[model samples]
Target: MATLFLGLNANAARMDMVDVSNNNGYMSAAEYVSMRNEFGVKAVTVKISEGGTYKDPYAASNIANVQAAGLYVNGYHFARYATKAQAIAEADFAGQTAKAAGLPVGAVLATDVESQEANNQSKATNDRNNAAFMKEIQKFGYRADVYTSGSWANNKMTIKGKTGWIAAYPYVVSGKNWYSSNHAWQWSSTAKFRISYGGFDVSQLNSDYYTAGQKSKVKPTNKAAVKANNQKANKNTSKLVASAKWVKETKTYTLKTAVKLHTGASTSSSVITTLPAGTTVKTDQVIIQGGYRWARQPRFNGYGYLATGPASNTLEYVKSGATHTYYTVKYGDSWWTIAQRNGLSMTTLASQNGKSIYTTIYPGQRLVVR
Candidate 1:
């Protein structure tokens, strides 16, 4: 029930933690520092290995840089095991690979088990194989957890007593609210970060994975100390700086459906007014809270949070006020797609917006298309 701010996951897209198609990418020391200072990142989970073979080339550099930046660095292995033997083999490889990549022992090293082969197996088989993998991973002196989608975590496998990192993105997240209880909740794959040109995968952790892991002089050999540490993590109600960012440029949106504007991000908050359909509202910021995407509209007294639509997208509640005037970027939007939607080339659109085609566009950014 407590809210604990946590860090994010990084793969080929290191500093920004953005997901790119290619398997290799870089994140500089400065970028890691920005992530820690600007975003309240306490730790980062980097991809280390896959199956029994592939080692992420960026893993060593990422671990070294994050540690040098004064943040905990964890690792995860992508699993491709259908049998117990294969799972054990993969775990051995992951353990060695993580060590080679500079992943410190005792830091969390989760096994990513969302592959098609694992999903296709029966629930019992999947659980057995995953348990085998996790047990093997722990022998290398590292904490282990299973990372999988919410559905797979429940139906395809069981995480009854074991630590888990479940992935499930809802329309709105009030704070640490998820479908299934777990050690960590990977709430968004397209989470927008200020320094990033694209969306990044972000998670909320509810464990001592980073906090206790960092401070402890040695691994807690006492079971009581371990239990107490986990309890403390769960009871930690430390307030986190709201990740919502205010945009510099404002844009007008004409409502297609009537919507209640609230005083706060959650719907349960006091309602300020119910703007009728076709109402044109100018908004400067977008917030993801209480399971909805809220547009912050400037009211006479102050600002009101208007529920534009589900967190997934806002196209259903409102549309652009006029043609070729301005457009606010949304998650999953790219320069080319925005240009195509507005009937212009990327170069033309960028030129109109006082940017270049190479410029990075992010959600809540306003672009001129005229």
Candidate 2:
């Protein structure tokens, strides 16, 4: 069959998501499910190697956990070579990494080629090595492909039989532009793939790449025969977790009733805004005080607090990666008192945020709690 790249067609199949990585960090299976469920991610592509030999320290763990989450996975090798000889070696290295990580036959082996550094490589060199990279991986029994940005104009490389994964930032890419078979699109850098301290790069996948469709879609010819097999497989699934850690619903929260924002987690604290019923707010820090639930308004439009009571029943969400929570000084608050109130270390908190333990805090001065 001739090769083709299709974007997400909700009716035809589901819109799948992918993430590429190279040891900046790794997510636990719980972490993966938490983030992926939030965005409906479907698969992940791990960075197995660089050039012909350098390996990603975290690829193995990431692959195992992501697969455990019941997501399809592929492996990729970052190209740094300039010769056919090096290209072939890098391809083999990638295959080894993938197989070692438990990726099976027919998994897509992608080449992440971009213009960021070019690392002083010439176009001729890039094209030659890139083409060879895809070809050799295919020979190793993979569904190989090339990844790049359209702006780089690096389309001169060969991908006639393989897929083209494009990184066209700030655009909602549909894989319709290059070589007539761009199989994947990295739509943006601002979007989060893993919403933790920092997130991973995310992309969308063509159904062809996930047709076997991860575990939840597993199809068996004989249900009676597969039941025993499934029982055995379940015993080995320690590497995966499903859904986000705390996402109860989709992004953008709506208030069920009227609410108020308080300076602190108290109903009697200074009210910043009394949001009417059905008002909207972004999820941020949520705390409990004085028999009520409080949420922080960290954004400009509704920057204040919202409390949970008869008037409002929703609590705010605090991001797990937030470093410090600031507190606006009140008339009687002191450095020591602030630290004591928030359970912060007075000296370390003051110095790190740029202040002194003895510095007199004033009313209205926002200070990082010690």
Best by lDDT: 1
Q: Per-residue lDDT of 269-316 in model 2, one digit per residue for the tens?
A: 686766775676665555433323455556665446555421112232
Ten-residue stretch with the least lDDT total in model 1: 7-16
Give the residue spans of candidate 2 off by over 4 A: 1-15, 22-24, 115-125, 153-162, 171-180, 193-195, 210-370
Q: Candidate 2: global Cα-lDDT?
A: 0.56
Q: Model 2, residue 31: what's the lDDT?
A: 59
Q: For all candidates, what are the clash counts? A: 4, 7
For model 2, what is the alpha-carbon lDDT of residue 15? 24
RMSD of each: 15.1, 19.3
lDDT tens digits by residue: candidate 1, 1-370: 1222232211101121222111324555665666566555667788888778888878888888878877777888988899999999999999999898888988888888866466459989999999998899999988888887765666788876337877655433434455335677676666443333344566765555534344422221233433343343334234434455544437799987677888987756898888998899999888654435678888889999876755433343677776667899999999989977865657557876778889898999999866
Off by over 4 Å in 1: 1-24, 213-370
What is the C-alpha local distance difference test score of each model?
0.67, 0.56
Q: How close is candidate 1 to the true structure, as a TM-score?
A: 0.53
